[model samples]
Target: MTHAIPNVLTIAGSDSGGGAGIQADLKAFSALGAYGASVITALTAQNTRGVTAIHTPDPGFVTAQLDAVFDDIRIDAVKIGMLANAQIARAVADALRRYQPKHIVLDTVMISKSNHALLAPDAVAAVRDELLPLASLVTPNLPEAAALLGEAAVTDEAGMIRQGEALRALGAQAVLMKGGHLAASDSPDWLIQEHGTLRLGGPRVPVKNTHGTGCTLSSSIAALVAQRDDLASAVAEAKVYLTGALQASDQLEVGSGVGPVHHFYRWW
Candidate 1:
């Protein structure tokens, strides 16, 4: 039997290291059997070590890129990553409003794995005010959730639910509160929505080569959601794929520092 593949778009920066950003998103899309499109909002000179320099496209150019993709392709879903500043964030939010894709997964990428500041402090407002209301699902780490709500990072399961509910109030239909930052043997994530919360638990993979785990997870969700009717199932399937990728991450010798997960782990 033949069927059309879902087309997923990633609006993010370019990671020269290829471990994260547009590169990782496209890889996840392909690995999950979805067609991928990209709109580059910024460019970074980075390796697994850290981001050294960043170059952001003009907001007008960002809008142009969005128009170019939406004009031609039927985008089934959108995975949004690093928006360099307020202008770019506003631009992306506006385009989303116009095109109105069925699913938008906003990965609140505030800092890089190596502690590089990806989002400008001023841009937080744009993301919270304009982007949050438009997202179908918002994926935020502990620090990002805190940043979004202007509070300290939560340290327990109760705090995760508290912040998740607050984030949902900000207009996103659902919030996935990631607890990978917690110092525990098991990694826990909570999916918070209007009706209730769903807890997803996984053993933490003991691997240092997790350079793009967050990017990979959010994009995977976006890609899977494009095909499945149920968001929870898509999220669960995405997590399974990510866990497998993380377990196999050490196989790839990409860089001297942190390395990328095996996106095509099932293949060569």
Candidate 2:
């Protein structure tokens, strides 16, 4: 008898640049040895420089895709990103309740690297109220966390820890608050759980080719969780994988602008 490979589903927008969103998630899933599937909520005409245009798919279509994937595939985990609007967010929340995947890793993507709003301002509450509670783990960068909390932006390591706890209080089952925006010496992600807390640290690769780091990290976590039994172990494993990917990102000269993390085959 052949054993089935673990499956991870990515529900997000398509980055025409191929560095972020559904593309990045699928790459992370496959690199980690999981079968990858996707449900695209929007289409982004974007590149390494910036997002130029966005087209949101109909909410009904999003629901149909969700149903099709859930009905046929034995999805072990779902990594959610870039729900174009509140309608799409509600559809995703409802599907998660219905199909009940074993793990949900939500990357609450808000803004892009070149300072474009990815999620509509009207949709913030839907993500917080509707989608957040369903998440087994929600990975929010500094700005996204502050937006969800409806508070001033987190500015420091101390602020990251505090807001991470605050976001957990806001109904996420678990929280991973990233300090990527912090002007600190190192990039640290504070993981807040029910039993305890952990500060997962990594070398801040001083490279401009980090276009998909957030999506990559969250999907890596989802992929690892799908293949493992422990949440802490998954987070730890993801941290290692992401740090290496970031370091290797500079190795790939994909675009004239900011490039992407190499879906590396070797460990240096």
Candidate 3:
């Protein structure tokens, strides 16, 4: 029997460098053989070095973009990233509640690798209150996790798990605590669920072209989950894909500072 292609929607910002946000999300969706759609929430004059300026559209226009996509396309899953402020977060949350997609991967993006602040400080509460409950999974790196929980960034694996649990308590059905910030030989991530926590470990790729890693991974999982894979399996597969992208990242010379992973490494 012929099967329809899975449709994945990414609600994110625009990256002029094309290494992250909506650009990275669509690349990941295509790499995973899913149809990708996007609703841009903000625009950034960004490069690998840093963000020079950011322009946020009104929240009503964000809602309009959501309406435009939901009205026509069959969105199987959604990957959310880079809500610029409280109003946009609430607006996106309202749209998600109305559409009720099967899988929603919330990437709690607060800061860029270049140390540029992406989410407003006042928006953290809105993310916890409105977006967390609607998310199937929330992927937060150490700092983002701590900011969400109103605690210090964790130093060890145990602290990561604790923060993950606390985030789950805040209403995210599951939490993927990313441990890339930790100083270790291997990169580890904990997937905390209602039943138990899963440890995903992989060797850290020694490459500087690691821009947009979070966006790529979350969108990959959303695409796989849209194809009907279980959450754990999808996470595992996405991890492997990310590892490969990181391993091959050096091949692409995209920018002066940090660069993007090879989204089409398998093909190219």
Tens digit per residue, CA lDDT, model 3, 59-107: 9999999999999998899999999999999999999999999899999
Residue-wise lDDT of candidate 2 within 1-268, one digit each (tens)?
0236788999999999999999999999989889999999999999998899999989999999999999998889999999989999999999999999879999999988888999988899999999888999999998898899999887888888898888888788889988888887898888999887888887788877888888998999998888885788899899898888877887777878888887663543
Superior by TM-score: candidate 1 or candidate 2? 1
lDDT score of residue 205 within candidate 1: 94
Which 10-residue window of candidate 2 scores lowest in summed lDDT?
A: 259-268
lDDT (0 to 1) per candidate: 0.95, 0.89, 0.94
lDDT tens digits by residue: candidate 1, 1-268: 1347999999999999999999999999999999999999999999999999999989999999999999999999999999999999999999999999999999999999999999999999999999999999999999999999999999999999999999999999999999998988899999998889999998899999998899999999999998985789889999999999999998899999999999999996
Q: How much does candidate 1 score in TM-score?
A: 0.98
Q: What is the TM-score of each candidate against the true structure?
A: 0.98, 0.96, 0.98
The count of backbone overlaps in candidate 2 is 0
Quote model 3's TM-score. Answer: 0.98
Error of 2 at 99 (Å): 0.7
**Superposition-based RMSD of candidate 2 using all C-alpha atoms, in angstroms:** 1.8
